[model samples]
Target: MVQTVISVAGASADCPEWVLIDLQGSLETRHPVPLSGRFVGDLHFTQKDVPILIIGHHILYGKTVHLEKPFAVLVKKERSADTSMETDQNVSGTSYHVKALIRRKLLFKTRPKPIISNVPKKL
Candidate 1:
């Protein structure tokens, strides 16, 4: 199994701040990741791994506006063939086995906001 990171940046002038992301992987995995800055949401990879982050914008007054901060999602790959066996004895004398593995972290940053004009005009 292989891990991949997807980084999205905000667009330039007159561009849309909202974006829809469709992620496809080797395991036939399909995930929809919406980009906004309003309310936060969670990105679920497969059935077990889910990354939590804030949404970028909100649809209010029939319009979509950007939020103050940006958001991101992280995904890691896990293999079924890679397994480990462990035995644990409890008070009931029952044996419990489990598998342990490590996953890497992915980081995504938001685009910088455009500067506005604040100069005064002289007549």
Candidate 2:
């Protein structure tokens, strides 16, 4: 499956080209990644493999948000070298298998959850 990584995009007039991102642990949301900086210019974002262009006062600063494929190596480390060779069991011999194989991808924009208001309204 694919993974997410938040990277810096553009710079401000008074500040150098830099951005700070904090992936809040255990609180992952697919919403437009929250941004906090000196000057947050007007933004146009979507949930797709598209570049995130930061426009400041009509100037388009182009930068693409990237995604990574999750991976794992069957190789044993140097200190634990030959460990893999020692095990003659194939993947099927063990309980190892592909968890998921994503062929078709679909992304639907979810609506905000409704909430009940405590304040009474006019009849």
Candidate 3:
């Protein structure tokens, strides 16, 4: 039987960059629904590379921090092969591959502020 070994991808320039964003708070939905693949907000950067997050009518400011221990995003891959023709035994196994590494994170610990429009009233 062929054995497959799973390991994290070495840190290299070819690896895709990944960043973890911490809101420092819990997210709540209106009707307690799943939030997978949902549109949350837009993240913008200032001239000094400071991160600004805009969610609905609230705006939050955050900073990037390096993690002490990096995290690896992995993907599972399965393979099936017939090991013996007489016995017709199938060899199936799964291996994980590192997709990306999270070395830094954007942290928004402070409370979000409301975005006010500065529109002038006409007489």
Candidate 4:
């Protein structure tokens, strides 16, 4: 298996959507990676509670992991894979910035139904 590294550019709320990722200066090839779930790791204070994807052998979150910088990460494809290359180094000393993107609002309308009732009234 070939090893590849990609920087986490951003994430989309819609599942099964193609997220944009920058491959850190390497432009020889491109591939579509289907992301099913978020990445798992002991994230730093900046990375906590953020959405991420598991690419190649690293758990990438935010834009904290630079495209041209080298960082240590856990190397495993499946949950049963041997996690021996795992390390405790994160995008060292990098601060995280959270930005919220606005999405189109969904408006739903329902038709009013006629009311029919039968009741006895006392005078």
Q: Residues 1-123, candidate 1: write the lDDT tens digits.
A: 222323233332322333333222111113555434533333434344333232222111111223335433333333233231231222122222222211233222333233343657631
TM-score of each: 0.18, 0.17, 0.66, 0.17
Any runs in candidate 4 off by more than 4 Å, and if so which? 1-49, 63-123
How many clashes (backbone N, Cα, C below 3 Å) per candidate?
11, 0, 0, 0
> Residue 98 in candidate 3 has what lDDT?
85
On TM-score, the stronger of 1 and 3 is 3
Order the candidates by lDDT, highest first: 3, 4, 2, 1
lDDT by residue (1-123, candidate 4, tens digit) is: 333332332562332222234333222224465444634233333435343433333444444222232222322233222343453234232233223222221111222122333546531
lDDT of 3 by residue, 26-50 (tens): 6777887899988799999999988
- Quick one: best TM-score, which candidate? 3
Model 2, span 13-52: residue lDDT tens: 2223222221212222356676544344334445654323
lDDT of candidate 3 at residue 71, scale 0 to 100: 84
Question: Candidate 2 versus the native: TM-score?
Answer: 0.17
Off by over 4 Å in 3: 1-5, 9-13, 76-95, 116-123
Q: Give every collision pair in model 3.
A: none
Where model 1 places Cα greater than 4 Å from the true spot, the runs are 1-61, 83-123
